[model samples]
Structures are given as C-alpha cells and as structure tokens.
Target: MKPAKNSPRARIVRYTVFGAISLAVAVITAFGYLRYEQRVDAMHPALTGIALQMRHDPAAWTRQERDASEMLRDIREEKVAAIGVSRDAILVSTQTGAKYFVTDHNGAFSNALLLGEMKAGADAPYQLVWLPDANLQTGMARWAAAFDKIRDLITLLMPLMLIGGLFWFMRREMTGGAQLLEESPTLRFEDVIGAGEAKAALADVQSYLTDPARFTDMGVRAPCGILMTGGPGVGKTRLAQALAGECGASFISITGSYFSAKYYGVGIQKVKHLFELARKNSPTVIFIDEADGLGKRTDTGGGPAEAESNRIVNQLLAEMDGFASNQGVIVVAATNHPENLDEALRRPGRFDRTVQVRLPDLEDRAEILRFYAAKLTSKADDIDFGQLARLTTGLSPATLAMIVNQAGLVARKAGASTITAAHFIEAIKIARIGDVSGAERALSEEERTRIAVHEAGHGLVAALLGTGVLEEITILPRGGALGVALVTKAQDKHLYRETEMRNEIQVLLGGRNAELLVFSEASSGAAQDLQEASRIGLDMVSKFGFNVDGNLFSLAALPAQYAGLQLKNAIEHANVLLRELDDACQALLRANEPVLRAIAERLLESETVSGETVEQLIREHAAASSPSMHLAQEPAAA
Candidate 1:
C-alpha cells in the first residue's frame, strides 16, 4: 500500500528526494555552461593574434591564414567552422586543417605574438587576421547567443526553484516543532534559588506535560501559555528554562524581538511557523524572552512596522488557540514590561497563567547567597550570610550572585586564600557606591573635614531618630558624591509608618543642618538630600494621606495637564508640614549637638565609622546626660 501524498512523512520524503535531484541538475547545467564560456574566452586572444597577422601581411601568412581570411573577412557570407566567439574576434579552423585567429583591435598584432609563444607548446601553428568592425559584428553576436542559452536554463528551473523553496519552508515550519526534547532536565526546579510560588505553579505544568492523561481524565485543559512577569534581572527568563528542564520537554527558545520585521507578513509567517513546529512536537516548551516587544498592542495609526507587529500578534493568538486538544505545547514567555503586552495576549486563552517573579526577600536572598557561595572554593571562614542578606535588602538574586563572585575576585586580588567578612563588605560597598578607589579623588584637609561633618550629621540623626540602621559613614568620594551615610532598613518594608516617614525627612535634612551648624551655611552637596526630602514630603501630602485632612487620592492617576494644579496644592501642603517638622528637627539636633560633634570628630579621624560605633556613642551620650548618683554619706557623719 502506498502512503497518502499529503501525509507529513510522505511530504518530508518527497521534498528531500526532490531537493537532492534539483541540486544535482543545477550543478550539471551550471558546470556545462561555465565550461563552454571559459573555452570561448580562452581562445579569443589566440584568435585575435592570428587575425591581426593575416590583416598586416596576407602574403606572409600560411595556407590556413589565406583560407581563414576569406571566411573571417565576411563571417556571415560563408559558414566558417569556428571553435568559439570573443567580444571582438573569433577562432576558426580552415578546410586544410589549419587554425586562424581574427580581431578588429589594431593592438592585436603585439598581443598575438605573446599568445603564439604561450600556445606554441601545444605544437599548433595559427595565423592572425585583423578584420574590419563590420566582419567582427558576427563574432560579437555569440554573446547574445550564450545569454539566450543561460536564460533558457534559468527559465526551465525557475518554477522548480520556487516549488522547492515553498516545500523546504513548509517542512521546516512543521519539523521546527521540537528542535530539542530532553529526556532529562539539565536544570531542575530546585536549581532556581527564588520564585518558590512560581516554581510551585510550574510543577503542575510539568505534570501536565509529563502526564496530560491524568488532567485529561479530570476534564481539565492544560494552560497553553505561562507569562512570567518581573523587573529586569529578577530571574523571569531563568524560570522559563527551569520550567522546560523540570518538564523534560523539548525546548524551543527564541526572543520576542525575533518576530518583528520592517516588512509585512514576514513576522506573521515566522509566528505561524513557530507554532506549527510546537504543534508537531506535542510535548514542547516554547520560551520567548522579552515577549512584550513581539506582542505589543496594535497601533490604531497604522504604519509598516505597526502593521507587521499587529500581524505577528494576531498570528500568535491564532496559534495558541488553534489546537482543539491540549497538544502539550506550553509557551513560557518572560517579559519585564507586562503592561506593554497586548491585552489579548494576556487574556484567558493565551497567557492564562501569570507568575510574578519578584525580587528575592530576606530568606530567599540568604538561600540564594548560599547557593552562589557554595560555588566558591577559597573560603577561610564561613560568611555571615544573614548579615550579607540584611545589607542587600532589595537586591535581586542575580545581583547577590554578582556580589559573591566579585568578593572572590577581590579576595584573590588581595592575595587572600579565602573570602572573608571584610571581602564581602568591600564587595557590597563596591556594588552600592561603585569603585571609588580608581577615581583617585584626593580631598584637602578642609574639604575632608566638611564632608565628614555632612555625613556625620546624616548618620547621627538616623541613629537618634531610629528611622533606619546606619550601616556606615564614609568621607571618601563615591559615585559623584563627596561622602555617603549608608543607611538601610533591617528588613524590607512594603509600607512605611507615619513616624518612620517623618524621621526619614529629618535624616535627609541632617546633612544640611550639620553644614549650617559647623560652617554657618550649606553647600551644593545637600542637593540630593533636599530633593529626596521634598519628594517624600510631597508624596505624604498628595498620595499617602499623611496631611491634616487624612484623605487619600491617586495624584498619579490624574491627567498630566491637571497634575500641575494638584502638584502645586500638594507642594503648598507639604511646605506647611515641613515647616512644622523643621522646628522639631532643629530642636532635636540642638539637644543632640554633642553626639553630632562626637561622631563628626570620629569620622574626621578614621575617615569611616561602623553603625555599631555610632549607636554606642549615642548610648554613651544618653547615659552621661543622666549620670548615676550615689547616696551622700557626709550628712550622716555630721
């Protein structure tokens, strides 16, 4: 029995055989034509020499030249047997078995002499005849003849070429289904450090891919797509890889940007082909990174690029919903910009499952740190992973890995065998403030003193106010700032209390206050501090409902044109609020002036101070203010 012509296997076999045959024919035809053309070209110079010789001295010519001249003089008058044609000459053989060369160029005589010696090795004598342009016209006509033959060959194969291309494209589109199917996963779900919830969600997906029958029995359809959303470096793409790895399915990874084109239909064709491949390879995981670029909302005002994007998006939607049964082709797409993706793409049928791959929290960061730390070898001591995690409160898993890798490099550069607490600390500072060591920002004694005073004020106020934990204070210049008071929350907080927010405002003003107290004026160094304070203050009044009225409204939701009025009102309210806070801040600073001066002195001496040292100093000052007293025994003696 013969197989059906339209069957997939039959198509593959037919096209494979057809392509092989077509390739062989093309090679043969091209080879024959090229050989003929080469032979014609090769004989032109020899023929030109012989033709010139015949023209200059017909009496000196051999029997071949005399006979050839008659034939060559009027090439169309009689049928002259010729080997080939040239642009301006022809090579012909006489009835007497002699060879003759002909040309119209006057310089052919000199060239003919050279060709005679070169071709003399063949032991064939030839004559040169210089014919007029009129006689040479017939020789030039052979180029058109050659072109005609080439055109005919091309005409013969053009249809076949087109058919072959269509067949190859379709085959690729069909077989593209599962470019790879892994019997086992190279990366398991456990390998991904964070995204526990996302990992759990994908576990069910793996079950569907591995055993769809179990779900099918329950009348549940497998989700066609899972959209992983998060900020950049949040491990969204890595989770996609882990999903494929866990499921042991074929992985076809492509970027969303791959399906965008300047030309129309190209992108749509690509999208169709991709889905066709996935359908053929039923148990396949298609991972698209940066999917927002491929599936952006269509533009109402259409252009070529816009039209192409819409076509691709439409094709993607069709493909996702095309299969009647759960084909086990789970598309895992990752995009940092979920809001930019088309609404249809995020709807029920397409990317039905959305997993938020957020920044790793404290516990997640600790585990992630340990995972990366284990990859390092020269560790003299066990790192305080808890302390490292606390320092990097909002850092991504990727950033944590970087810190660990950078710490190893730092330790190696210092000729240390193991990564120590100090190495990690330096790495954190480097990650936060950048490498100031390379900048060579040497400050004068007076300038260093002012920077010390400014940073000391920030650290002292933050410690006193209990707004945040003062990590470190440095007078060294880093990241365009003359100094920095590194303060961080002990843990990540999604919501800030009113007192905490107020204290933050005070802390921001500390640097400016310190400068005012010491120099009786402030410098441009407080620009960032003032800007941050203003933003927090304004947000308190406008967005957070921290004003007198205690009302919350979404200022961000307002139109841009109307925002100016709302923003002005917010700024007015904030100013009134800050005025009141300013008095409290001034009074607090005045009472803690001694502590501020003490911290500043220490900073000037050491150029840096730890958080614990600042806390200890504040505690000592507090204790001294209410010194312990002993009973007066003198009264009893009297």
Candidate 2:
C-alpha cells in the first residue's frame, strides 16, 4: 500500500523540500541585507546631503539632487530584494511616485512585526509617511527572487527525471519495499550431485516454505537455523544462496569475520542491530559465512577475546531462539570447521538442523565440469567426460572450475581457436600440481623419473586393485606436492569399507615406495603423500575402528554432544594416537612391500599411466590375480 499522505515520513519529504527552500531564501535575503545595509554608502552624510537640502526647500532642489535621491531609493530597493524576513530589519519604498502598498514585494518571505513598528516611529519629522501592510509588501518583494530561482531549478530538474525517481525511492525506503531482497538465480536440483540426504533435508525445507500453514497444524516447528557444514569448496554457500532465491525472502549476508572491532561489545551490538533490522522485515534469511569466527569454543583458555566472542555468540543464540519461528526469520550459516563452533550454540534451540555437504560424486563432477565448460570452446571431439572425469579424480567443484578456466586460458594462449581435449588434459595435469612456467622448479632427471614412476605406480595399483580405483596419474606437482596420483571412489559412497580404506592407504604409499625403489631414497617430495596416508591409517585405528587393535566396533564421527567442539580434541586425539600410530603404518607397508615393488617396476617403464592403460594391462593379463597375476600370466605368455 502507498504510504498515507499525512504520515510523518511523507510530511518529512515535503518538509525537507520546504526547509531547503526556506534555507535558500534566508541566504538570498541575507545577501540583500548585506548589500543594502553593509555598504554604508547610502547611509553616508554626503550622499544624503542632497535629500536633506531638497527637504529644506522642497521646490528649490536641483534635478541632480532629485536624481541622487532616486538613485538612493533604487539602491534601497535592491537591498530589500536580497533581505530575508527571518531576521529583523527596516523596510522602504523603491520609487517616489508609488505608494508603499503599490510597490513591488519579495515573494513568500514572511513579513516581520517589528518592521512596521520601526517604520511607523521612524522619527523622520519632515517626511511623515505611514505605509499600510508595508512589511508584508517588503517581505514578498525580498523573497520573490528566491521563489524564481527555485522555479527555474525545478524546471531544469524535470528534464533530468531524478526528482520523480528519488521521491519514489525515498517513499519506498520509508515504506519497507526497499528492504525487499532482489532475485538471484536458483540452482536446479540437478546442479547438486552429492549429499542426497542434505538435498532431501533442503527439499523438506522448501516444501515448508511453500506451505507453512500445512505444517503449522501438523505440530511441526520450522527449523530456526539450517547449519550447512562441510569442507571448503563443497558448495555450502551456493546451496544456501539457492535456498534464499527459492524462498523469495530478503537475503542479507555477512561474514563472522567482518564483525571484528576494537570495542569489546561493539561486535555484539552490531550483531543485535543487524538481527533487529532483519526481523523488522520478517520472512528474511540471514546467511553468515564462516560462522566459526563468532561460534568458536569459549572453554579454551584464551584471553579477553574469548570472553567478548562468547557475548556475541550469546546474542546470536538469543536471536535464533527468539519467539519467531523460521517462517518469520531463518538463518543459514556455513562453516568448513563445524568442529570449531561452540557447543551451546549448536543445540536444537539454535541450529536445529545441520546439513552435511559432502564432496560431489563422479557424475556430479562431470556435470560441474560440463557446467563450467559451457562457455569454453571444445578443443576437439576427444573432449570426453569419460576421460576427463577419470583424470580429475578427487577434485572439488571449485577446483574443477579452475581447471576448466585455466584450460580455456591455455587454449587461448596457445592461439587455439577451440578448446580441445588436449587443453583439458593439460589443464588437469597442471591442476594436479600447479603451473610451472618460466622459473618453474627444475627437478633433476633422477628426481623426475622417481616422481613420474611414483605417480605411475599409484595409478597402476588403483587400476589393478580388484575394483580398479586409480583414476589418473600426473607428474605435475599441485598444492604442495612433487606429483600426485588420483584415485576415485567407484561411486560417491559416504561410508567406506575396511578394504577400500586399506586399498587407499596402499595406493598412497605406492608413490613413496616407487620413489625409494627407483631413486633409492625418498625426498621431501613424498611429504604430502605420506601425511595423507598416515592420517587415514591413524583415523582407521583411532576413530573408525578399522585397525581392530584399538577401540573396535566404534563409529568415529563426532558425537552429537561434542559435534561442534573445538580443534583441541582433534589435536589431542592425534597426539594420543601418535604413541601407537607408527606401528600400524609400518605393518600395512610391510604386508604390501612385494606388491608395491612389482607395481613400481611397471611404472618405471612409462613414468605415468591412465585408467585406460591400467584397464588394458589387466585385460591383457586376465589370468593374473594382482600385479602377481600379471607375473603369473606373464610366464604363460613367455
């Protein structure tokens, strides 16, 4: 509804316009007063002497003296033209022939009470003239110039068209429509390939938003907060933004990190103010990115920072748990480290529903790559997802996009008209390690052979393992690595089997073993591989109960109570497992020693291989049961 015409806000717009006009008139009038009174030229005795003499002998005065009086009168009118009525001042006539009432007046400038009293008792014995409503005439003439200027300005502004737009804009802001959220593109369900459970959860929420009344009588309470928790680049933010678009609610986004301030309570105050603003416009969704900043655990013995942050979290908790349901106010917070959030804040009253956003599956990756490549030119008919997906194993959606963009850049730089499979292939190789252009790290020939063979060994092992896990092998170093071998899960299966975990560890070790056998020593190049493999093995023993040596029959995921705890527990767990972890890694390596050596031998031939190569190897030596199968089948062929 349009705002009522008499409302304070509407009046404010009108008053503001009037006040501005009043100020302008006051300035012009002051200028006129200064011009008339400040100069003191008209008030000079020499200038007035002609008028004094003319008054002494009314009929005997010369034409020059009369002209002087006329000039003085004209000057007085000019001074009055500039004077605003707000301040007290004297008034006079412009010409001798016209009466004071017939004289010109300034427009709209208020006439003053003191003006008449001063003119009536002027003490001019010789010229006894009492003017009627002369003050009103003077004010009208003085302010007329101001009105004329405003009218001219209004005419000029009409052409600019900003007046109407600004009026509507201010009215819209005053009324509440300006606070309405704008439309954003919502991703189709097809865009999100993994997290079926999370999708179902989101779907339910969508349904709730569509028909809140339907759930109202069902005794269901809308979730106050939907906590999207996952590793980085897993698309938590994209999904929430999609939800915002889907619901058509006001979307206000702020990062927890942006709340920092020198004052202890300033962040808390800002948080309250923001929430209040959001609530004032109900049916709003506030998305806080990286909420760990405000939600970090408070029990840690940090300084005053923890105490202040706790206050901020406390305010947020209150806001979430307030009387309003999700129908009125909904909050979606995304954080990579959900484990770092405070415990109290994660309870049901706060973030009632926690959605786990896991990595995308192969199909999802293919879709994501296709989505990103939509704008790029196809390099050749060889640009196949079958090969691309296999090559880009374990890459996040974001990483996949970067690879595609970089591939396009490579195609452009090479002066290729169309992006081809070779560009994608090169992009994948580069993504695995990173670009090594000019001043790129120069490895020794021996180191290069070792890295290439190590990656090849891993690829071969993954492909030869019963189900064939190896996706690709690259000598390109990416993300703090010399080279990497990628292994993909057959499907994006969340739960891992002991055998799969064991195979993954073995695959991780394949590179180190390949380097050791080929180069006779492992360099820091194996640092990342060893770190990953060790962590997996350690988790198997500590949390997953895969090791059977310690805490069997236990699910290692965070307990409901301790879900959003801090990093301290994770660190302590790593430390405790440290005492018993080394032996497990050593045992797994020892059992796979022969197999690793055999795989390394095969890798030494090619230095790198693809899933297709591994498949071909197994197909060529079908009778062979592992790398041993190749050897056993090999003797028959020989």
Candidate 3:
C-alpha cells in the first residue's frame, strides 16, 4: 500500500526529491561559474615585461640593441608566431592566439612596414608573418559569455524555484492535511456531561446519521449542517463528536484556522477538499472547531487578505449548499462568537439549525460534578455535589472538571488516601482565586488590623443585609487583594429586585465604610470597593431605571438630543443614591461596631474566618447589645 502523505516515509521521499533538485541546480550553477572563469582567464593572457616595454616605448628597443636581441630570444622562447612593424606601429602575434600592438614614432621602423602598408616586394617587418587563430579566440569568447549568462540565469531562478516549491508543498499540506479519524470517535451521548438542550436538538441528526435511508424513504431531508454556539469550553465539540459516535459514522475534525493560509486560493482549496472528503466517506461527520476564525468577511476594498477571506467564506457556503441533504454528510461547527459568522453560512439549507450550548445550570452542574467525581478514586459518596454546584455557579463544564481534578491533586499533595470535603474546599479556593498561599506578604500590625477590619466589615454587612451567604472572609492575601470576603448565594439568580441591588451595592461599600468609621478615614484598599459600588449604583440608575422618580427610561433608549442632559441627571442621581446608601451603611456598622470589632479580632488571630463563625459572632453581639433588638435575617426568596 502507498504510504500516507504525511507519514515519515513519504515526507522523507518528498524532501529527498526536493533536495536532489536543489543539489542538481547548485552543481550546474557551480560548474557554469567555473567554466566561465576558465574562459575569462584564457581570453586575457598575461604579458611579459619585454613585451610591455616594447608596447610602451618602442624606441628603447633600438637604443638597447642587446636588449632587442634578448627580446627576440625571449619572444622565440615564448613562442611568438609573428612580428610586424610599420611607420607608426609594431605588432606581435603568438601561436596561442594572442596579439599585442605598439605604436612606433620618429620613423623607428624605416625599413619595416605594417601588414596593411606592405607591398608585394617590401621587406617584411620580421622573419615570419603568422596570424593568430582568430576563430579559436572568437569561439572561446562566445563560450565564456554563454557560460556567464547561464550562471546568472541559474542564480536568479534558484530563489524563485525554492519559493515555488515551498508554495507547492504548503498548498498540498493545506488542502490535504485534514485526516479522517482512523477509527470513529467513541464518545457517545452518555459520554457528554451537560448540554441537555443541545443534545435534544441533535436527536434528529443522530437518527438520520444512523439510518439515512429511513428519512430518504419518507422524503425527509436530514440536517446537512449544525452550528453549535456557546462560550468556549461548553462541550460543543464534544457534543459533535458524540453525535458521530452515536451513529458510528466516520469523524473528521478540523479547525477553522486550518483553512487560513498566506498563499492565495489555498483556503478555498482546503474548504473544497474538506467537504469532498466528507462526501466520499458518506455518513461522515465533519466537526470544525472555532468556526469564528473564518467568520464574516469585511470588505474594506483591502487587497489580497480581504479577497482571500471572501473566497474562503464563499467556498464554504457553496460546499454546504452543493451537497444533497441525504448525502449522509453532516457538517458540525462550534464557535464562541456565532454572531460573527457570515450570514450566508447560517441561512437555511446550510447551517439551518443553531444549537445554543449554554452554561450548565444548577442541576446540570451537579450532574457534571458527579460524573467527573465518580471517575476519581475518592470518597465520591462523601462529596456534596449540590454544595459544590452552588459554589461553582456560572462556571463552565471545563472549569468544573478542573476543580475536581485540582481537588484530587490537593488530596494527593496532602498524602491523603481519598479526597475529602476540606481538600475540595481548598481546591475551590485555588481554582476561583488562585493558589496564593505562598504569595502572602508580611504586613505590619497596623496594616494587618486594617485588612482584618476591612474584610470583617464586608462579612458583617453582607450578613446584616442578607445579600448572600458569606462563604469565607480572610485577611490572608490572595491574588492582588490584601484581603478577601467571598459570599455565595443560596442558588443562582436570573433577576434581581431594586432592594437587592441596593443591598449588593451596600455590601460592596461596607469595607470602605468600616475603614472610614473605625479609622476616621478610608484607605486606598477601598478603591476596588468604591469602583464596584459606583458601577452598581450607576447601573441601577441608568440601566435598571431604579431611580426614585420611577422613570423607566433606560439610558440606552434616551434620544440623542436629550442623551447628554439625561446622562448627567443619571450620574447625579447615582451619586445622591450612593451617598444615601453610604450613610445608611455607616450607621448600621456603627450600631454593630462591637460585632465588626469581634470579627476583625478573630480574623487577626486566625487570619481566616468561616461564614458560620461570623454569623455566630453577629448573633452573640446582637444578643449582648439588646435582647429585644433582632438582627436582620437572610432576605426572603424573590
């Protein structure tokens, strides 16, 4: 059997062919250059000193008669073929096809005559009148010119040849590199954790891939393309592979970036080849990951880049439309940004169905956690999936997996036999904020006191206002924060009430308010707290339309003519609302100053305080202060 195009043997053969061609070109170029050099040397023979003296000063030859005899002897020894003299010139010819000429003045050659000036009976300038082989010299000069031209031509073509070869190799790879899985993916529907709705949406696709003839008989067309849209790591690609595995069809996966190349038309070729391969396999599933890389093309009348993009997109559309619905070739593509794709690709008869793989919900998160936890050699029964799911609200499936894996790693690092709740908790902290245990900075007593107070203030206020369940509050530094107070809700919330938003803003301001009340001034640590509080206040006023005036006009809906004035009003209203909230927050903290101080002192002692401990502290302080006065309870479900 022929070797695969990308196999080592094939690669070696391909490279060898290219290498041989390059070597041959190099050899020819070198040979031509050497030959040209030889001809050049032959064309210009070296002259002797006497020959040079005769040419420059012929009269010196007559003054030095002995020197003339020596010149004759030297000429005879040097194989000078002939010598000619005229009234104003003398010429010497050599047997090896070289000729030298000298001008003679003062009638230096009275008896001698030039070849052109010689009569039939005139005495000859020399004993012998020989002609150099003009034909041989002319031929050799022509040959040298030819060799020089050949060398220059080869030198010029070398780079072009190499570039052309490279383009060919790249084009071949780009168009043919996408390999179908030697064996179909084994990831079935059961293998995918979340994305129930997405799976349900793809049920028909699964059925058709299993039995295309069943649909064909009923004259029903199977979905030719599926576009899975979701945030990254939401299991879209896995779901696609599952669809293929469910039917045991061939799976071919290629990223959208695979089609992009610097060479013109290479992308188009890749697109065509990809679809063609899928069709040939019949009952094949083509999964293109990160399809947004080949997204909507913008026409700025730009040059080749824009044109190439347009062509690639156009080719993709054509391929999708060109295939028949019953061809049993389904093209599944996943993209984080589905809106960026070309409209043509999303139209009917192409990627007609767009499946949204949303983030896993509470129940789904619980299921996913159980699925991953079951695979680990841990106390899976002891692990509370519900609590873990609640703690990981809004996290993707990938992050959930990472948390479980990290938990196992944490357990292993502790030299524990099985994972435990405490290990998982530590893992959660590491995953959420990052492992900053080693990053803790040495703080002075005063700064440590301030950090403890700041974090304690946040926890106390959150508990007092029932914003959320305080998970943990710590004076220990993590990430960029000198202190952190983590609060989690009882469950995920999709909507919020005006009072709840105000309560959240208060919780954000709690730290800063505590610093101000305790130290008579706030520190720079409140910068993030102030920014977050300001953002919530502004959103409430401008976006949520939660102003006191009861106006429902959103900032985004404001008329352009009134936008500036309305926005100014919104900012003023936000500022007024924040001041009011700040005053209320400070008052609450002042009344419960004992409780804040107690929490801060506990944090200073242990560097960390659990939510239950803070709540106990609050209850103790409230009861000690006044038996009749009740502390705020957790807010009721909306």
Candidate with best TM-score: 1
**Runs in model 3 with CA error above 4 Å?**
1-168, 174-176, 217-219, 323-326, 437-439, 558-566, 628-638
Between prediction 2 and prediction 3, the one with superior TM-score is: 3
Model 1: how large is the Cα RMSD against the reference?
A: 13.6
Each candidate: what lDDT? 0.75, 0.62, 0.80
lDDT score for candidate 3 against the true structure: 0.80
Residue 561 alpha-carbon offset, candidate 1, angstroms: 4.1
Q: Which 10 residues in a row give candidate 1 its minimum summed lDDT? A: 59-68
Q: lDDT by residue for model 2 over 363-449, one digit each (tens)?
A: 778878887888777844567976677667677888888999999898998999889887887788778766644321576766666
After superposing candidate 2 on the true structure, give the runs of residues whose Cα lies further than 4 Å from its correct spot.
Answer: 1-180, 183-195, 217-219, 296-307, 324-327, 379-381, 437-463, 466-489, 505-638
| Per-residue accuracy of model 1 over 406-454 as CA lDDT, tens digit each | 9999999999988888888788888878766533246778787888888
> For model 2, what is the error of residue 464's alpha carbon versus the real structure, in angstroms, after optimal superposition?
3.9
**TM-scores, in order shown?**
0.72, 0.57, 0.71
Give the C-alpha lDDT of model 1.
Answer: 0.75
Ordering by lDDT: 3, 1, 2
